[model samples]
Target: MRLALSGVSVRIDSSPIVAECDLTVEDGERVGLVGPNGSGKTSLLRTVYRALDPFAGSVALSGDDVTTLSQREVARRAALVAQDSTPDFDFTVEEVVAMGRGPWLRAFESTTGGGDATITAALERVRLADHRARRLSTLSGGERQRALVARALAQESPLLLLDEPTNHLDVHAALELLELVKDLERATLCVLHDLNLAAAYCDRIYVLHGGRIVADGPPAEVLDPELVRTVFGVTCTHLTHPVTGGLLLAFSPQQPVRSPHSVKG
Candidate 1:
C-alpha cells in the first residue's frame, strides 16, 4: 500500500498542531518521521489512519481519498501501533490479537476458522506463539509491544503506522523491536525520536520542525550537522560504523568553548 499526504494540516480545538505537511510512504517502504517534541508528528500520523481528520489537504491510500472511505474500510487498509496501546484489562494475548479481525466481521459476528489461523500466524510472526495463553499484563515491555504489533499484523493491512514503538524500552529491546519491524516488509510510516535508530532502520526520513517539514530524503542526505544544529539546537558529529558502514551521529549541547583562567592562592 502507498500512503500520501498532501498539504495536510491539523488543529485541536482551534490550536494549530501541524501545518501544511506533505509526505509519502511507498509500497513496502519504511519511512520515518523525526522531530523535536510537540512538532506535530503524532498529529500528522493520526490523519493517515483517519483517527483525526486533516483540517486542510488530503490523505490518500493507494490513491483513494481517506474521506471517501468508511471507517471500517480505512481500518481494513491501514493498521496502527500507537505508543499508549497497552490495555487496562487482563486480556489474554490471543484474545488481544483476535481483536484485529473486527473490521471484517459483522455485528455480533465472531472469528471463524480462517480468522483463527490468521491470529495464530500473527502471533508466530512476532515469536509470541508459545505465550498465546498468557495475560498481556504479565508480559515484558518488549513482549507487550510485540503483541501489539502482532495485533496489527493480524489486521492484514498493507499499510502500518507506528508511533514511537520503541518508547520506554531498553537499548537492546529497542533494537530488537525495530529489527522485527524491518523484517515485516510492510509499507510503514513510523515516528521515531532516536535519530540514529531512524537512520539505521528507515529507508527514507522526513524531518519535522515547528509543525512543518524542514527536510526529507534518505538518511544520508537529510541528516547533517547543520540541519541538526538548526532544527534541534545541538551540535552533531557524523561517523561511519566500522562493521556495517552505516551512518552514526554523536550530539552535544551547542555551548561555546571557554578559555582557561588561572586562580591565584
Candidate 2:
C-alpha cells in the first residue's frame, strides 16, 4: 500500500509542530526522514500512525483517509516502532512480541499456534530468536530495540513507520537492521538520525527543517554539503562509500569544509 501525507499540519497548545508537509512513499519503497534535533520528524510520523491528529490536511493510505478508519483498521494498515519504547512490566520477550497480534485478537482470546509461528518468525527475522525467553528488562539497549522491531514485524502491516530504530545499536547491528529494512517487501517510512545510514538504505529521502520539508530527492541530490549546513547547521564533506557506493558524510570539527561542487546557496 502507498503512504502519503498531503499538506498535513499539527499543533500543540496552538504552536505548530508539523507544518503543511506533503510526502509520498509508493509500495515497497524505503523512504527516509532526516533533520536536525526537534525538527518534527517524530511528530509527523505520529500523524501518520494516528497517535496525533492533524490540525489541517490529512494522511491517506492507498486513497483512503486515515482519520476515518477505526483504530483497529489503522493498526492493520500501519505498524509503528516508535523512537522511545520501554516496557514497564517484566514481560518476557515472547510475550511482548505476541502483543503485536492484539489488533487481530478478540478480547479474552489467547494466541493460537499460528500466532506463535508468526511471532517466532518475526523474532528470527531480527536475529533475536535466542532471546525469546529473556525478560524485557534483562535485555540491553540494542536488544530491546530489536525486540521492539520484532513486535512491529509481527504486526504484519503493509506499511511500517519507524522512529530512529537504530538509536542504540552498535555499528554492526545498526547496519544489519538497515539491511533488514531494505530487504523487507513493505513500504517503510523511517526517521534516521544518521544521514549516512539513510543514504545507504533509503531509495528516496525527505529532509525536514523547522517543521517543514525543505528538500526531497534521491540521496545524492538531497545530502549535499551546503544543504546539510543550511538545515543542520553543520559543516561536512560528502564522499561516495567504496563498499556500498552510497554517499558518505564526513564532518568538519571547527570550520566548514569548502568544495566547489558543494552547493552553499
Candidate 3:
C-alpha cells in the first residue's frame, strides 16, 4: 500500500497539533518520521489510521481517500502498533491477538478456522507462539510490545503504522523489535525518537518540527548535522558504523543555537 498525506492538519480541541504536514510511504518501503518532543509525530501518525481526523487536507491509501472508507475498511488496509497500546485488562496473548481479526468478522461472530491459523502465524512471526497461553500482564515490556506487533500482523494489512515502538525497551529488545519490523517488508511508516535507529532501519526519513515537515530524503541526505542541531537543539557528529556501514549519530547537549543555513567553510 502507498500512504500519502497532503496538507494535513490536526487539532486537539481548539489547539492545533499538526499543520499542513505532507509525507508519503511507498509500497513495501520503510519510512521514518523524526523530531524533538512535542513536535507532533504521534498526531501525524494518528491521522493516517483515522484515530484523529485531519481538520484540513487529505490522507489517502493507494489513491483512495481515507475519509471515504468506513473504519472497518481502513483497518483492513492499515494496521497500527501505537505507543503504549497494551490493554489494561489481563487478556491472554492469544485472546489479545485475536482482536485483530475483528474487522473480518461480523458483529458477535466467532473467528473462523482461517482466523485461528492467521493468529498462530502472527505469534510465530513475533516469536511469541510459546507464550500465547500466558496472560499479558506476566510478560516483560519487550514481550508485551512483541505481542502487540503480533496483533497488528494478524490484521493482514499491507500498510503498517508504528508510533515510537521502542519507548521503554532495553537496547537488545529495541534492536530485536526493529529487526522484526524491517524483515516484514510491508509499507511501513514509523515514528522514532532515536535518530540512529531510524537511520539504520528506514530507507527514507521525514523530519518534522513545529507540526510541519521540515526536511525529507534518504537517511544519508536528510540527517545532516546542521539539520539535527537546528531541529533537535543538539549538536550531532555523524559517523559510519563499522559493522553495518550505516549512519550513526553521536549527540551532545544543546550548544549555541545556529541557523540551519549557516556555513562554516
Candidate 4:
C-alpha cells in the first residue's frame, strides 16, 4: 500500500502543528521520518495513519483519497504502533493482539479460533509468544513495547506507521525491533530519533523541521553535516562503516570551527 500526503496540514486548538507537508512512500518502501523534538514528525504520521484529519490537503493510500474512506476502512489498510501504550483494563497480551482483527470482523462478531492462531503468530514474530497469556500490566517496559508492536503486526495491514517505536527500549531491544521492521516487506513510515539506525535500515529518509519536510533522499545525501546542524542544531562528523559502506554519525557538543578570515574579533 503506497501512502502519500499532498499539501497536508493540521491544527489543534487553532495552532498549526503540521504545515503543508508533501511526502510519499512506495509499496514495500521503508521510509524514516527524523528531526528535532516537536518538529511535527509524529503529527505528520498521525495524518498518514488517519489518526487526525488534516486541516487542509489530502492523504491517499494507493492513490485513493483516505478522507473518503471510513475509519474502519483506513484501519484495514494501515496499522500503527504509537509512541505510548496505556490500557486501563487488565487485558491479557493475547487478547490485546486479537483486537487487531477488528477490521475483518463482521458487526457484533467475536474472535474465532483462527484469530487466536493469528494472534499467536504475531506474538511469535515479535518474540512475545511466551508472554501471550500474561497481563499487559505485568510486563516490563521493553516487553510492553514489543507487545504493542505485535498487535500492530497482527492487523495484517500492508502499510504500517510507527511513532518512535524504540522510545523505551534498551540499545539491544531497540535494534531488535528496528531489525524486525527492516525485514517487513510492507510500506512503512517510521518516526525515528536515532539517525544511525535510520541510516542503517531505511531505504530513504524525510527530514522534518518546523512542521515541514526540508529534506528527502537517500540517507547519504540527506544526512550531511549541514543538514544535521540545520535540523538538529548539533555538530556532527560523518563516517562510513567499513562493512556496510553506510553513513555513521559521530556527534560532538562543540560547534564547527570557523575559517581564519571569517572569524569575528
Best by lDDT: 1
Candidate 3 vs candidate 4, TM-score winner: 3
Tell me the tens digit of each residue's lDDT in model 2 across 15-44: 999899999999999999999999999999
Q: Clashing residue pairs in candidate 2, if any?
A: none
The local distance difference test score of model 2 is 0.88
Q: Over the stretch 1-265, how does candidate 1's per-residue lDDT look in tens digits?
A: 8899999999999999999999999999999999999999999999988889999999999999999999999999999999889877898999888888899889998864434889999999999999998999999999999999999999999998999999999998899999999999999999999999999999999999999999999998899999999999899999997878999999999997665664344
Roughly what TM-score does model 1 have, to 2 decimal places? Answer: 0.95
lDDT for 125 (candidate 2): 91
Q: What is the C-alpha lDDT of each candidate?
A: 0.93, 0.88, 0.93, 0.87
Clash number for each model: 0, 0, 0, 0
Regarding lDDT, does 3 or 4 come out ahead? 3
Q: Pick the candidate with the highest TM-score.
A: 1
Q: Candidates ranked by lDDT, best first?
A: 1, 3, 2, 4
Query: What shift in Å separates residue 117 of candidate 2 from its native position after superposition?
Result: 1.7
Tens-digit lDDT string for candidate 4 (1-265): 8898999999988999988898999999999999999999988888876778899999998888998998888888999998776467888888888878898889988864544777888999988888888999999777788788788888989998989988978998888888888887788999999999899989999999998899999999999999898889888899989888978999877567878999787
lDDT for 195 (candidate 1):
97
| Local lDDT at 215 for model 2 | 98
36: Cα error in model 1, Å: 0.2
